[model samples]
Target: MDVFEAIKSRRTTNGYFLDKPLSDEHIKILLQSASYAPSHFNSQPWRFVLIRDKARREHLGKIAGRSMREVMAKGNFWKRYLKYFRFSKEETDKSGDGIHIDNMPAVLKPFIKYLFSEKGGEMMNKLRVPYLLAIDSKKLVSRSPLILGVLLTKDEYKKDDLSGMYSLLALGMAIENIWLAATALGIGVQFISLPMEAGGAYWQECIDMVQPPENYELIALFRFGYIDPNAKRPTIDWSSTQRKPVSEFCYEETFGNKWIPKE
Candidate 1:
């Protein structure tokens, strides 16, 4: 696929990938592609730990499941992440970003709407959505042939510092490079967001298990493998999976000054 096509068509895999494992050559190519991304002052502070061991992957999946349960048990899951779910076209239009409800599984759609109501929280807990989701998540993680763990070297950016900001920007570029390359190769990628959702204290356990090289901290985890062409389409519609119009976000010269491209 063309580079632009890959970039424009790339989508996050929210469902399970096929049982295929990425070849060693494929992994090497992805890492090489990522290494080519530009970095601040050429610092290139990113480090990657690739997890392919089934036992270790299962361990990570367990950690992910535990972390997910801990978050849902707080009883404020909807309140904390409400803005990130768009259930209708109007809602998606207004936000211009966030996960569209259509992308969610069919079984979860009605429950998602219920989540906004005062009683929905109770319903969610009653239905054990969190537990069910965790089970599904474990199946995904355990079955994925590869999990790429991204790390950043210590003593660089503090996230609030200027250099740190640049380093992060570079890291994003690196991630995109890998993602696009993988997309071109017919692979799918999904984030392991449970660690962040569960917070540092819990994430430390994941770090210990993954055992990244010394002097590095885990930044992100992404599962990658081939997609199943025969998989059923997700129940929710996916119109918003496409990028928002440039006019919605791009500005002419200042904030709130919309930019209109000429034909």
Candidate 2:
């Protein structure tokens, strides 16, 4: 696929991937693409762990599931991230960003707003919503054919210096390259992020499992596999494809001057 086409096609795989595993060739290609990202002083500081063992994958899945349940069971998750939830197409169309929660069990329709309300925590737990979501997360992740752990060399990712920021930027670019390459290869990718979000012991467990060397720090985890065309939507799901127009984000040479296209 063309580079531009791959950028346009790349998406987060929110549903289940195909049962088939990724081939060695595809895995190598994904990492090779990341190698091309520009790093500060040519210090290509990224490392990737290709996790293919079934037992390891299942263990990670359990961690992810528990993390989800932990986060969702608490009020802070909803409090902190509620602004990003768009309940309807109209909401997403107007905002041109953020995930649109367009799929849910019919039972959740009437309680949608309530579920996000400050008073909903008790009711949410009563309904076992977190448990259901945890189950879904576990299945989506554990059954995945591969889990890729992204790490950055501590030498370049130093916390006390500007190199850390530079290294993170380079790492972001490298991940983008990998995502685009995966798109071109017909592979789907999604961040296994709840463990990080839940933080505390949950995040530590993930870090322990990924087991980055003392010289490297694990920064991200992603699941990769062939896209399943017939996968069913989860009990609840969100899709974010709408993007803000250039005029909304870009500026002219002078700040505050909105970018406008010439007719």
- Each model's C-alpha lDDT? 0.79, 0.91
lDDT of 2: 0.91
Q: Write the per-residue lDDT of candidate 2 for residues 136-160, one digit (tens) a residue.
A: 9999889999999999999989998
Query: TM-score of each candidate?
Result: 0.90, 0.97
Candidate 1 segments exceeding 4 Å error = 103-111, 117-119, 232-240
How many angstroms is residue 62 displaced in model 2 relative to the true structure, after the best TM-score fit? 0.4
Best by lDDT: 2
* Clash count, one per candidate: 2, 0
